[model samples]
Target: MSEWTCAGPSTEPAYDPSDPQSGRALVNYHLRELGIGETHLVRAGEHGLRYCRTLVPEGIGVCRAYVLTEAAWPEGAELCVTVSWSPTAELCRNHTTGAIPTGAVEHWRQRIAATAQALRSVGFVVEPSHVRYSPVYHSDADLVVYRMPEGVPARRAPAAADWALTEPVPPNHQRRSWTYPERSPEDIVIQALRDAGLHAYHYEDPLPSGRVGARSITQTVWPPEADRCTWLTWWPHPTFVRDPGTGLLPDGAAQHWRDSLERIREVLTGAGLTLRTRARPWHPDTDEEVHYLAYRVPRG
Candidate 1:
């Protein structure tokens, strides 16, 4: 018989009133203070508390960022604060801040350093001296990160002043598909068509492979068929689309594809385009078929 090795209870309890997991506890605490009903704890790794609305506890004594819930933020809201640690450490500023401070070049450096230290204290063998920073603007798609902590090399923090206040893209890069009893396929197709540049409407089309019956799609573009085409198209392979009724695919690959699609949708929407979806259908025969279409609606 093989013996099992138990690391014993995590060095710390899953819950500690003093430290309480940084992200969720902070979010839950804030939501409670605001009397926001039905608020749920969203597990988003380290950055979770940053997405939540309520400010983190002021006197926690140490400085670090946490993920916040995305849906809670008001549009275009900017967070500002000065982070002080080593007293003499530069008073860091954050304007276009998420849960973490932003706009303070020195503060970012410090946080990254602190995180490196925290990781090491937890027994990660990382070299903070080699750390470096890089600032990313107009993108939060890669906001959350988790590594062995100890083995990471130093990287510079992106200058906070350089970061613009905008919604970071969701880390997972997949399309978020939701089905509602009231939302019709035609409605979705029309919305996507208008989002794109060319004028289009829902047109009849046969579905691909095992799907039954044709669903909805954008019909045509405007300019009387101009010699130039301003539209581009791509399709998700069978491996990507899963039956919502049935959750299939290996957990990791499925989640990756899902997040990828969501990222693509955000990029398209950011450019004023929409990707309307329809029910999978048959009669189109093979897996390679136009499952959906996006048309650009002429902007006035």
Candidate 2:
């Protein structure tokens, strides 16, 4: 996924001062009346078409023209436009013939297909309308409508579903099934990064026996957001033991870093391990008491 820049509209307050929905209706009107091709006004859920300048103003947001076949259109000619709050709210005009660089469309189309396939393989429905190709960007190519399985919310849909069909299912049904993580608030977080987007996989790590461990939480922050900013991999725990007076380690420590002194002891105690509590900082200079349990899982 390409970086989702705040593109398509101006951030400045609208001079016309029209309500968002009304503004959308007005834009659709001009597209139809002006033969600007058919247009759609979309928001969170509701969407409609307006067909005159009176209906929608000319200056809207970035609009993309689609080659509408009788089949493509449910009613008449159809054009899909993207409206947003950004720097260029004025509707995007139709691109010139060959305006899209040669192979650009194909490139995005291929990416869409590949992403769709990957999503499907993970037990998702990869539908036709999901793959969109109208507005092309130098960095990103298309918009993909990712859908979830029968019971999941649209917001929590898995990515690139088609990939599931190719891989063989694991013998362990528990591991094979998709179990939304319990600890984390969201099952997945997709954010547009520089060249590619960051997809954070938040799920419980499955144990070898296919059973989720009590401490089964796992988070995979992909493509390390940037070079300078190191990603913080953290885990949380309820409580820990630490001496308040001296914030330094007592020495003879293996994995007994100051940060883990209290929390590790707590976890160990919780797991029925006999250990002594000591006062220490996670690092040499820090003095904050450590409560959230964390460890760096080795990555390949």
Best by TM-score: 1
Candidate 2 Cα misplacement greater than 4 A, ranges: 1-99, 130-132, 135-300
TM-score of 1: 0.23
After superposition on all C-alphas, the RMSD of every candidate to the true structure, in Å, is 17.7, 21.3
**In candidate 1, what are the lDDT values of residues 1-300, reduced to their tens digit?**
222332223233343222314433333233233332123232333543322222232322233324322211112212111112221113322224522244444444555455445543533232322112323321110112222223444333334332222122111122123245433333434345345422233223312211111232111111121111122333344444544566554335444444444554564466554444433322212222233233233353
For model 2, residues 27-79, the per-residue Cα lDDT tens digits are 33332443332333332322543222222223322222222111111111122
**C-alpha local distance difference test of each model:** 0.31, 0.28
Candidate 1, overall lDDT? 0.31
